[model samples]
Target: MSAKPWPEGTGCRILQEVDSTNAEAQRLAPTLSGPEWILAHRQTTGRGRRGRPWANPVGNFTATLVMQPGETPDKVALRSFVASLALFDAFVAATGRVALFALKWPNDVLLNGGKVAGILLESAGAGGTLSHFCIGIGVNLVAAPSRSDVDESAITPVDLQSETGARVTPEEFLDLLAPAFADWEAQFSTYGFAPIRQAWLNRAAKIGEVITARTGKESVVGTFETIDDTGALVLKTASGRRVISAAEVFF
Candidate 1:
């Protein structure tokens, strides 16, 4: 059970099955009066960054938080960090082990040095004005895909049950996650991204360590310095400090 209550006026819906929660979010965006969480018991067509297939495998966690954030695209996008911090807190709340988890830059949560959860952001707009934004998250709670399921350069996937023996259902985990996210969202709303960036850095994986960030055919290898105020990944290369807005990070 979450120590904090769900944020007032937030809505939650659980479906026995769906093609994708993000898709559902897009469809529900126009009708939502406030932020809403959509969770699916099973996703027949789950997806990851770059439209890669995401393995569902039943009993895992798959959901999306949809809301109308009336902000610039860049500002709206920083919620990925907000979501990352919330996931960290929810994980700690579930297992009572803070030392076991670390957050990967950009949008991944690491458990025991392996990828345990991932975040994907999507938005709708016209003429550069925003309409709605969705943060889709997936967690390996009871099962993980085979090594062959992921790209060769990707980190191995780990599940909560396998790694920590914590048995958390999708619904129960959402109960923990939604409130944690609300708290961080409140912090972000109040103090801006300064506190969120610092908080994310404190729990960041590979901070101050050598890492590789790949963008298509190009790759930069450098020491993980920090995430800039704008949420860009800052790497200290021999050439200089490089700020990357998007890329796949590997340790």
Candidate 2:
């Protein structure tokens, strides 16, 4: 098979293995001239939110894009929505089935209600502005960990190969992903979060369903309303609508 192609002017480094794409991105960010992508065939110490272990089998997709957003860290954080939408677009394009996938709140991509991918955004610099940000994404392309392999309480994992009954390599997946991400990132730059927010709600998983959001300290149960203007999750409870900026969601 031929090598996968990336978008024009985008720099990429593909590794046989790495500690973590995000960590490598952070280490290389200082010398990168522009937006660059770091991809690894396998990760020895991958991680997810809250420092949970992220399983990175050889055939799955493990990559990170390092860039300077030129905005406050809080503003750049909204790129999570952008990244989620990009993954949705890429998945649909790759599988040619829009009905099989959904975007979960915060940063997860689900297939038939089972997670197929996860997104993690980490940044450097203090105060308000961010010097650089690493958007790490892990997609289960050829293999997925069993529930037993990860924390038992975590959501069951899904793989693209099993769902579509076709073989897809990590490189093929990234070819579709890179351009989709660029498109969404451009839209976000020109139109702000309004369009991304609307697109996300359109593909959102379990909106309007009764669900629970678990903040580290407490859990809030309510009907999933919609995401507000600022991207906070809006949940309707007996009292009123509560906007949550960060939490683990369960439906």
Model 2 regions more than 4 Å off: 1-5, 151-153
lDDT of 1 by residue, 1-251 (tens): 45578778899999999999999999999999999999999998989999988888789999999989978999999999999999999999999999999999889999999999999999999977889999999999999999988889899999999999999999889999999999999999999999999999999999889999998878999999999989999999989999998999988
Worst 10 residues of 1 by lDDT: 1-10
Mind sharing the TM-score for model 1? 0.98
The parts of candidate 1 lying over 4 Å away from their true place are: 1-3
Count: clashes, candidate 2: 0
lDDT by residue for model 2 (70-185), tens? 98877799999999998998888787789999999999999988899999999999777788999999999888998888756567899988888757787777888888888888
